[model samples]
Target: MTEKQPQARVMIVDDQPMVLEKLRLVLGAHSDIVLHVASRAEEAVEAARSFRPTVILQDLIMPGIDGYELLARYREAEELAHVPVVILSAHDDAVAKERCFLLGANDYLVKLPETIELVARIRYHSGACISRTERDQAFHLLMVSQRELAAANVLLAKLNGIDELTGVGNRRSFDAAMAAEWSRAQRQSKPLSLVMCDIDLFKRYNDAFGHVAGDFCIKRIAAALTEQLRRPSDKLSRYGGEEFAIILPDTDQAGALLVAEGCRMRVEGLAQGESSSGLRSPVTMSFGVASLSPTRDSDMTAMVEAADAALFEAKRSGRNAVRHAMEMRAGQRLNA
Candidate 1:
């Protein structure tokens, strides 16, 4: 089925009674056109706004405030800014027509135009104005949608790197951070530290307490370890089921060992807090510390392996001790 086009709304503004009556009779004869008349230039803007005419038929010369002022006023009004204006003047002066065009008239015609030509011009301008308005609204909506989509993509990227259960960095986040920090430290000739810690006897704890309590214990331990790292440069991430890693940039071996011991003590204190919550078993963490100032010969794998070896030693010696990766050579072993 063919859709019917919308009716054209035409507003006529002229000072002469004869001209107003003539335009009313000519436009009112058409069934597809809605007509409104304003005899005074001062009231044209207000009348056009209320009527919301698609095409304004305006006279160039009027009694009080001239058509030039009225045309400028219509262009200034935001609601009437895009509505087409056709200047119909008695004087066919080129200078006057140019003045009307500069004042933002869309078209100009001398006195009594042919009925067919007048109606065609009105309908054509009316359709063009409506199309431009719809096009602008659609462009505005598209811009809003694109901005919203960009924001959503940023949020999704952030959420993808986060650990769901503990609200901390996941292993993927840790890997990316380690690569970036390692490169930065090597370039700046600064020391980078890694602290790897695991909950001691986690399987036994899970057997004694249900899996739900086990998850709760892991969350509490993660929070405690987070509290021990004071600087914003330090990052904590869940590297495994019961294991977590901390990255400390621009820190020496001595500083890294202290941080590991602090985390150990923090986790040990979790037992007392758990007691209030009805869990009886004590919780302790074994920590491995490794720190190095990267040289051209040093690699990321070497740093990770050193920390992993130290962690194995901590687990071997007893579950609750903090072992420095170079403690055998540096004599900086810390046990609790």
Candidate 2:
């Protein structure tokens, strides 16, 4: 369905009763227009306030106040400043037209002309005024819509790097965070730790149940891991399928071990399904913790590699356990 156009309010001020009636008859049936009539200048001001007209048609000669005085009063009102005024005068002299223009008259019409001409002039000027008002409103709405669209784009950009299923940072976000935090830790001479967690025998679990159940299991474990990271600087993300990573700022080897153990116990308590892996009786996680005081020349790739080596050792020795990178490096030399 098509929408109807908005109506414009118009006020007519004339001392003659016949002239006011004629104007109403001419403009009343036009689309989206309302006509208001006043016999005196004082009544016209009051009608303008009440009707809030977009345009005012005023008579030059009046009893109480002349058209010039009425125009001055209308201009002084802040609320009525934008309403356009057209002067109707019996004197068509050039001096009178110039004086009316200086007094803020938008247009002038002489009564000696044919009724058709007067009506046509009134319709033309009023329509133009209403059109200008609508254009201004539309421009303002466009500006507001543009601002909201810009804000939406920023939010969409942030969501692109996040994991939808787990509500945690994804692999890309994890890498970016590691690179930024590594530089800051080196500058402050603080220890940085990383914990790599793997769900024990996850492939067997998925085979027994279905992939849907496996997805649910991963999400639950991610939530449990996030609860253990209460510090503002602690960061966690989904590294890959059935695996997660945590970045602990200013944490030493001892602190990293404690955090990893906390996550391991929480996942064990869930016990969503049976594990086929012979090492662990139920569904659980194995964690590898790595701590280092990074220097300006430290590489993030090396830190992640050390953590992954520790994780492999945890799985090989026994499932549902925690291993430290420093201990694994020491054991390697002893075996040699």
Candidate 3:
């Protein structure tokens, strides 16, 4: 969608109604301008408050609260101070113009001047005012954009193990999270658990549905798995093609098993379309869980290997079952 351009707001302060009308008629042809008319200095100040003009054209000779006083008030106002004000009067004396300039009148113009000269001055002053406004706006926008970009970079850095296709954390992210959590667990002496999950018959499913469908299936499963981990310390990531890993900080074997079951159930409920071969069922995942206390001398590599082995056993036994690593190594002595 195209954005709308902003128009410049201008206020003309003069006691004479005829002069105000003339000024409007001269500048009205410029669609980018919004002209405000004020007949008194007090009225001009009120108009300035409401209109928030970028430029003010004020008459020097007024009945009360003359242009000089109005300019002083405008300078005192924090929001109105930056706005440029030009003095307009019938007195074309150099002394009067210089006094007005010293008192903060941006420029001085004689009344009933040539139309071309009037338009030229207005355009020139307005252009400078608009340029400054645009510079301030652009600086603010640049700051905002820089902040957003910094946030995005932080997110990207935290997303280890993310799958490039689906924008999910990849295996590397999962491993780093596990290592950090393990250290924390060792310090607090809390339980830590890991879950390794694989898509059932993913190779066959991919053969029947094409790689595109396979990718879709993986993304859906990854999203579902991530959704299951709502806790701040829980970590989920794509382990590899058609496989994912989950880290459950301060979770026992039973807790990990429940999380794995929930993820499995959610993936099975996705109701994806049929494969190209039209024989395979909708997507489903199998999980293997391992839990232990991470000690000072523990080896995370062995624990992850044990979880991976359990996942292989689950696949060997049945496609959609969850297996515990301790059960698989019941006859063998395993450390860490």
Candidate 4:
């Protein structure tokens, strides 16, 4: 099926009333063209900007601004640049034609050409202008779509990294962060610390209270653990159910121990009230602190293992205590 095209807009600019009337009469015969007339150059510029004509018919000699200056103005304007301007002049001088071309006129014609020739030129230039406008609109829409897609991708990445229930970094995010921090510490020869924290008797707590209350308890403990670290480089993640991990970038054993102890004290301070199920007490968490001057040869999993082993010791030594990986190792060596 053939699609119907919209009528092309034609603007005639001339100071002479007779010339304007003639052009208007010629264009009025065609139903596919809309005619707009301006008797002054300033009025022409204003009309072109507002009307957004597909083609412009401009007179070379006019009051206030001549054809050459008006043509220059159209060429300079971003919105008017795509519309073709055909100059109408009484004198068909070679120098005038060359000057008009240099000023960006699309075509130069003596006063008025034959009706058929004028219509053909107007149709050709108007069609070209329409094609250019369509292409520009399509390109702009594509750019907007690309920007929206990029924003959606960023939001997806954030949602993937976050734990939905606790609003903390999930296990996948923790692994990525740990690998990156490990490489950074190795490159700078700085100490990096990791703390594995578990709620003491969390299974018992969950068994005594409902899972709903257990969930609330974990969220509160996570917030308390997050509050212990002061450095922007430090990160905390929900390692698994009832267990959390802290990344202490550039922090040594002493600093890590201080942060771990702070988290322990904070969790112990959380208010507890008696429930209908059973008698409730304040929640306490155990911490396992491990710091290492990371080297390129060291395995990342070994650090996690050390932290986990320290955590086991903390649990063994009558729960709710903080244990250092190095201290555990030293004690083990002495016993051996």
**Among all candidates shown, the one with the greatest TM-score:** 4
The pairs that clash in candidate 1 are: none
Which residue pairs come into collision in candidate 4? none
- C-alpha root-mean-square deviation, each candidate: 5.4, 8.1, 9.4, 5.3
Q: Mind giving the per-residue lDDT tens digits that candidate 2 earns over 18-92? A: 887777777776766688888879877777888888778889999989888899888888767768888888888
Model 1 stretches with alpha carbons more than 4 Å out: 1-54, 58-79, 87-105, 108-112, 205-209, 270-282, 327-336
Residue-by-residue lDDT tens digits, candidate 3, 10-113: 78889888998888898797776789888878787778989988788889988878777888888888778778887889988998887787777888888877
> Comparing candidate 2 with candidate 3, which one achieves the higher lDDT?
2
Using all chains and alpha carbons, the TM-scores for the candidates as numbered come to 0.72, 0.66, 0.61, 0.75
Q: Judge candidate 2 at residue 308 and give its lDDT.
A: 86
TM-score, model 4 to reference = 0.75
Q: For residues 24-128, what per-residue lDDT tens digits would candidate 1 score against the true structure? A: 888899888999888888889999989999999988888899989998999899999989999999988999888988989999999779989999999999999
For candidate 2, the clash count comes to 0
Candidate 4 achieves a global lDDT of 0.86
Global lDDT of each candidate: 0.86, 0.81, 0.80, 0.86
lDDT tens digits, residues 228-303, model 4?
A: 8798889899999999999999999999999999888877766543343222557888988888877756767878
lDDT at 58, model 4 = 88
For residue 92, model 3's alpha carbon misses the true position, in angstroms, by 20
Residue 90 of model 1 has an lDDT of 90
TM-score of 2: 0.66
lDDT, residue 74, model 1: 93
lDDT of 2: 0.81
Evaluation by TM-score, superior candidate among 2 and 3: 2
